[model samples]
Target: MLALAGLLGLGGTVAVQAADTPAATFTVRQLTPETALRAVQAALTHCRGLGYQVSAVVVDRAGLPQALLRDRLAGAHTPDVATRKAWTAVSVKMSSAGFAAETQAGKPMSGLRGDPRFMAAGGGLPIEAGGSLLGAIGVSGAPGGDADEACAAKGLQAIADDIEF
Candidate 1:
């Protein structure tokens, strides 16, 4: 009986050890400079095709701005806003609408709004490929947020073949 009890205890310990092991953590890969430039250029071209003067921004996985450009006729702050919107999407790995929902649930992320680098708006989108997050693209100065988001989405779609997220 003693030997049987000891074996049971050992088995229980092994079970607990298995349960305690943490799951593997997946790391998001940052976008390369060339990929970032391509995304930005695509966004710019799309906006121009729409006859819209706008600014577009690309950000790496860490939410840092990689590239930002404003059309010559865009407002002075267009580039800044676009960069902030891109940063918000990359940092949170979600669209600005998701952030807004979280805030609406009494989880105030007003701190993000206060930060000059964050823009919790609809013009930003996460750049995901192969079920992994690569970064984000943001467009501003369009006629509306929907239009801006459309341009950004087109940019990501253009580089779909090159991105593995």
Candidate 2:
């Protein structure tokens, strides 16, 4: 029971009045809008430095958008795509690139693509620290999925230290 409390403490541990009692509630970590905005900015800047116009989106752990940015020259579709990618990352708890690979045509998981909200692109990455998922970031319109993924990685790297707590 003591060991269980330690393991359950991501944001905080659940209260266990007795060994046989169930926890009534649990705490969870969440990303702030400021942090989410910073991630999107870093991703967008990285794409711009590479001469690729793009859009970036950050979604909370619950798959809700916290921040979003679209470059002036980015295609209108980029914003929606970026949001979908971020939402998908948080929803699936994995990088969109990995999801794309797993759900490729003829793959057993390909049917997941049928969901309108699931964008199996490479620009999405889950934001995690200390084994807890805080949010996710996504980038789009960077020439290719690989480039978009790289930009999203930069976004995550930018805030790695801040999210550790």
Candidate 3:
């Protein structure tokens, strides 16, 4: 019985074990450069349609900028603003406008404002599909945060059909 148990790897330090086999494999969806560019274009067009002259930024799941589009008349700082918004959205996995509201003065999350990379503003929205986060989009140079958020929403709509969740 002892020999059988040992051979079966049921006991002892020199016990045998079952051979390893590859188990589960995962397929994570990523935002391609073309998709990122398409999102940027859609955001820019949406903002322009609203006479916003905004800058749009698309960031990957890691909060890295994948594409950016700035209107000719947009302020020089618009790109930075847009990029920051996209980063905030992907990093936190939520809308920048909501984050802003939650981090306002007197809120428990106010400390988040201390982070330079964290922006408590609107215009940032996370892009999610099939329950997986793809990336984010942001718009800046609009007259207000709401306007910027609207443009960002339009950007996400451009690729809505391509994602599943």
Candidate 4:
């Protein structure tokens, strides 16, 4: 009798707990390896066409490099610069150009330059789809930060058609 009572109570408690469980969902969009490769290639092509030896890097949402491409003469350290730019972009979700501008202005967020991973340059841009940030792209080894940014923008443009806003 006592064993039966305990079993019934346990069953009731389990049912009550299940009924009280919350129904929450989490979803996100991410880039494929093929997409990352294409982005890097597009950036490389754009920079090459402009007579610039540049490096491009694509990073995932966590700021991890997915792909990196460097021109034959992009310099030995170009890849590292590109990866850092990508990491900075994804870490803050702000174009490195925009971040540089803000940091230069010295306002509410003046300490942006203190972070080692943060770069106040123009070659980093966040990649987003449907208001969700998917990753980032960065270019380096161009004549200037603005020029590097142009290459990074090309990378993002290459994949814009297939992704949402």
Candidate 3 deviant stretches above 4 angstroms: 1-27
Runs of candidate 1 with Cα error greater than 4 angstroms are 1-28, 105-116
How does each model score on TM-score? 0.75, 0.86, 0.83, 0.83
lDDT minimum window of 10 residues, candidate 2: 7-16
* Backbone Cα, N, C clashes tallied per candidate: 0, 0, 2, 0
Instruction: Give lDDT tens digits, candidate 3, residues 73-107.
Output: 99999999999999999988999998898888999
Q: Please tell me which model should have the higher TM-score, number 1 or number 4.
A: 4
Q: Model 3's lDDT to the true fold? A: 0.89
User: Please, what's the RMSD in Å of model 2?
Assistant: 8.0
Candidate of highest lDDT: 2
Q: Per-residue CA lDDT of candidate 1, range 62-128, in tens?
A: 7777877788788887888788778888788888656656655346665565656667677899998
Shift of residue 57 alpha carbon in model 2, Å = 0.7
TM-score of 1: 0.75
- Give each model's whole-structure lDDT: 0.80, 0.91, 0.89, 0.89
The digit string of per-residue lDDT tens for model 2 on 46-130 reads 9999999999999988888999999999999999999899888988898998899999999998999999999987999999999
Q: After best superposition, candidate 3 residue 134: deviation in angstroms?
A: 1.0
Q: In the order shown, what is each candidate's alpha-carbon RMSD?
A: 6.0, 8.0, 5.1, 4.2
Candidate 4 lDDT over residue span 79-160, tens digit each = 9888888888898788888888887755767687888888788899999988899999999999989999999999999999
